[model samples]
Target chain A: MSHSSPASSEISFVQHHDDGTFKKTVRKVTIILSVVTIIELLCGLAIFKLGHGSHMAVLMIKGLVTILSLAKAFYITSYFMHLGDEIRNFIMTIIVPLLLFVWFIAAFLIDGSSWRELKNTAAGSKPATEQVEKAVAPGDKK
Target chain B: MSSAAIPAGTKWWSGGKSPFNLSYGKMMMWYFLMSDAFTFGAFLIAYGTTRFSANYWPDPNHVFDSAPFIHGGAPLVFVSIMTFILIVSSVTMVLAVHEGHNMNRKGVEKYMLWTILGGLAFLGCQAWEWTHLLTGDNPVLVNGEIVEMATTVKVNPWGEVVPGMMHNGHQVTTPGPVAFGGFFFGITGFHGFHVLSGVVINIIMYIKTRLGHFDQRGHYEMIEKAGLYWHFVDLVWVFVFLCFYLI
Candidate 1:
């Protein structure tokens, strides 16, 4: 129950920690996260300055900000969550599942774009209804 | 204490103790956070898909332009403040966890108080933003009439910019993609809920710390687990800020 107790045989490692260095790393990570967030904010402002018409330039900047945001996420999860100092196999268990997002984002965006294309090109569809129609009972409708 | 009782060849993975070199509680917390990440990921991805489905989506710059007490405010100013607030809270939380490790109950209490204050500040900002958006009138040309509208779950007024109509210095716009308002409120409201719960958890942790609960337990690992949840909140905000405010 106390720090004075010897390293228990139940746990494998004898943790050797220095108070000063731990605080130092905390400070370093905090500053890094702040700077990265500032850069992201600047990118947002740049997008505003570039205006709406320059599609390519605006897209590029948005991509940059997205990457920077990912970096910020990494810092928070790794340092603030202390996952970086955790054992290797434990870290893998967390990181490996997150990789699922790559395919998840891609598939949704792709299909969404495709559906838009289909909707716009189909001219034979009935005009959009202005009022909702009541649903028919299963066997009552002719 | 029983190191000699075990067979000499017994490996960590052979199951006498945690192979992860961590407590079950911390490992379970990690798994919980991973699942939470997927939840937010699905929300954001759904938002993106909805965005792609629409031809005339609202630009975030125009939509988030106003700040409190600043008429005709600049873009990204207020939201940046919100982001920084969450970030600062996260830092305080990590410090609290560190104090817990060192068995400094006073230090932990101090940092926990600061973290709670930060969470409440962030919530207050969110409340104002939501209120302003919900009640502030912006004129829109609907059915050949300039009808006033506010951003709501069912409607968005920051549509494609209309050519030449203005009322009280607010631009008239065609109705935007309805899902824009839906996603904005739904996702942010969800994130705010997480922040709310995190604050509550931190409060409980603080009260227990005040009562010497962690001291009795001896490890302060409870504080570490709560710290993980708090940082996860901050981590989600990073992406939420990107999805709603910046891009």
Candidate 2:
């Protein structure tokens, strides 16, 4: 058991004091994450301001935001969360569920096409507003 | 030199350390973080799908508008403060872990209390935000039109629906798609729940530390575990910020 253990004084998940690199890694990435976040916020503001109700602009903003978020997540998992130093098998175990989760999202997004069809259906053609107003007006009859 | 003896009833791969060892606590923290990761991932993914699939999703700025507050006309200042609070808590957590390494019980308690306070404040802000969402905007705007009916007008200032309105978009006098409300409630609500649980765990650890439990054991694995979970909370917030605030 002792042989299997890295060392009584060894750092397994993080290697900061041994070479003092871990703090640098976390600091560097945290700065990066903060910068990216600021940029995304600016982009979000610009899209809302300059895009002028353009659907494509909305998509662009959403895409940029998601990309920046993924960057931060990657840094956290690799550094702050210390998955980068984990064994390949352990990393893969984490990766598998995440990949599956992405697949599930893809499936749902595809399924959401059904929503478009619903939007075009006779029932959905009516504005959500009119329906509510009508429903309330009738209820008021009582 | 004698090899260290593995504790009884423990698997060879139980980190080859006692279940009560610092290493074991670290591993357990990883497993718990993994589960938490899945939960947050699911929420973000679902939010993505909803945003993408919707015919006309409200702009994030419109959804989260900054408005002037009564105090010095401060508008939407809390979000910025919330971000900083979370970051400070993260810093305090690192300090706590550092103290744990030195086996400084009082230092651990001090930082732990600060971290727990930060967490509570975050939760309180979340609750206020939720109430604002539910009560302020009944018929928030989605596209250029209103979905639900509210007593007051809501505006979208970032040219989302139209400039110069509330952040959740202009509150129109129409009913919104229930699906929109459902996703909003589910995703943010779920993240808030995680924060709540994290706060509770930290509180318990704070009490135990105050009682000198870790000092007696000659280790501060609980502090490390708490640090792991606290870091995970910050990790997930980064994602939520992107999905809800930026995107």
Candidate 3:
């Protein structure tokens, strides 16, 4: 029962602790992730069926999938990466970069949407009839 | 009179004291994982933004249905198998590290060899999937018509898909669209690269175990470190599968 004495044999490399519970924890995480993944796939399939071609539905489903995927990513990072045993500051270090990335993505989205709007407006006012009329007139004169 | 009383030589980063009794090699692997984490994060975020910007993205079921001799092909089945393989490999890696800790050399070799095999198998599957995707085995609709697909590499973040890269359904098309192959290659290609690298590392460790490097060290921190890397590879694949196949 004394904790001070060390084992002398070659097979005593591992600390004399039972890893049964550790294995259980790993199994639990695996099951949880697998279930979550199945749910995500189902949702993805259903959304395509229920909301095909509807822009709003598309946006909503896409957002849901992204969030769920991020959740799975975090679970794997935290548990499988051993970040759960690491210091809180280390976890924050990993997380802060992700926040900065979200900021970058937001900027990109703003730029993209504004550019789309600008393009739409530029072509929005052109009348098919008038444009055809002008083209035909120029051809007729020629 | 006690050797344990004497202060040990400490490294600069570790303050001349070994934190967690870890070696330089192990510590370096940790930092590598951290930085690698950032790299994969950026790739995933970029993928999200690209998906958001695209007016319409193909559904995974429609994109990944490749059955050699089946009808109503689906995405979940093949990708799910890939996911299962990766996860099982990760478990084998953990068991290898555990066996290494126990000084069970034979156990370590057995598990590590299995882990290496798993990694190789995963890489092979990924390569097959990529060829199938790039060559247009799966169906992709272009311009609102269910026309045959074509892909070409053009300038992009990862690489360009020029016109005539692939042809499908009787349509000769140029690189489909910029984001199409871009995201596909960017996300999965990166993960595949990690798996390939992991296979190499695991093989090295497997050979070293055969050579009795770990037994002399009295610890298997090397195995633990390799486990860390291998797990990261598997973890990244989870995200990639979700993004590319499910989400």
Candidate 4:
């Protein structure tokens, strides 16, 4: 608190220095986001037209759109949130914990399917053994 | 400016300077956003699990096949407008932060106003959608009887259409999974709340800029922090758009 020249001292400590491409980078990212969203919407339309009977095609398009949304998320966080410009350690601090989501999602989805199987078996609507054979494609069952 | 004068052997962890070279406020804000991300992630994952368990979930295309004024069908059209609004608002927010970096108070204020307006516009769109879902009547057959239903937490009228069933000139349908309406309203309402708060924060930042508070302080880090929150809101919308509208 007693240090002199606080302005000069504080200025150098700032991390996101202007490298003369700040505006250009922002514009590029904006275009990228818009394009990615357009592609995602188009993929959505494709899935809608494919209808539920063509389950494989709908799933593939949904996967593509999910990847596209992730790309949009990357641009938003890396550029808009300035996370990309932060120190490496700081970036890791935000990212490392996020890795937990992988297991969180996987476990929940598997458990949900397991619960459905349990309900089917308890009801005796379908034997457990036959369910395995039928489970190959929910589409076929539908 | 002593960053350049430090010797090679200087221990970054042994000094008063931040090892991350970030202000405490900014670092805390980043961590807060990280936690918030998990919250939304959990909500979405739960919704996914429920969907996976159900044999027949309502198709988003069929469920969202109407717009504000176009009575019949415009699949993915209105929601795209909302997504576009959010993306443009995020761009304006980053511009506001950029202006803040340059200490240009006028630029910051201008961009902040646009961001606030965009946020409000999104909220308005959400309000209209929820109202439509709550009030629009759709006839469905529940246990072999024709009944009028609106999408709500305990009820869903978007089930598969039954063959040879028609009521009041509308196609009669079976009842949909109740969890559908629950998750839809739960996740989206939470997201809309975040957008509302983001606008509030942007408003405060705008007032600060207008009052020259940041100018007197010699920096606009406040605007940058608020921008971070605003962009996080937009980022969440990207995923929401994916889960709810697109897929």
Local distance difference test, per candidate? 0.85, 0.64, 0.65, 0.85
The lowest-lDDT stretch of 10 consecutive residues in candidate 4 chain B is B1-10
- Candidate 3 per-residue lDDT over residues B39-132, each given as its tens digit: 9877876666665655455566655666434333564667777777888788788778767656889988999988988888787777766766
iRMSD for every model:
6.0, 8.1, 8.6, 6.1
TM-scores of the models, in the given order? Answer: 0.91, 0.72, 0.74, 0.90
Q: DockQ of all candidates, in order?
A: 0.40, 0.17, 0.15, 0.29
Query: Evaluated with TM-score, which candidate comes out highest?
Result: 1
Q: What is the C-alpha lDDT profile of model 4 across B26-59, one tens digit per residue?
A: 7889999999999999999999988888778898
Q: For candidate 1, lDDT tens digit of each residue in A1-142?
A: 1342212335565342467877888899889998998999899999889988799999999999999988888788777787777767778899999999999999999988876776676441434633578898899977
Models sorted by DockQ, best on top: 1, 4, 2, 3
Candidate 3 at A90: error in angstroms?
A: 4.0
In candidate 3, what are the lDDT values of residues A37-126, reduced to their tens digit?
777777767665764567687667768877876777766766665565543444565567657766776876676566445445646445
The CAPRI classification for model 1 reads as: acceptable
Q: Kindly indicate the candidate among 3 and 4 with the higher TM-score.
A: 4
Q: Write the per-residue lDDT of candidate 2 for residues B1-247, one digit (tens) a residue.
A: 1122333564434454432223655666777788878777776666666655566655555555643253212322556566667766876776676666667788889999999999998888877766666555344455565555422223321222334555453323323334565666677677778778888989998898899997777667677677878878887777777666665
Q: Candidate 3 at B1: error in angstroms?
A: 41
Task: Provide the lDDT at B161 for model 1.
Answer: 82
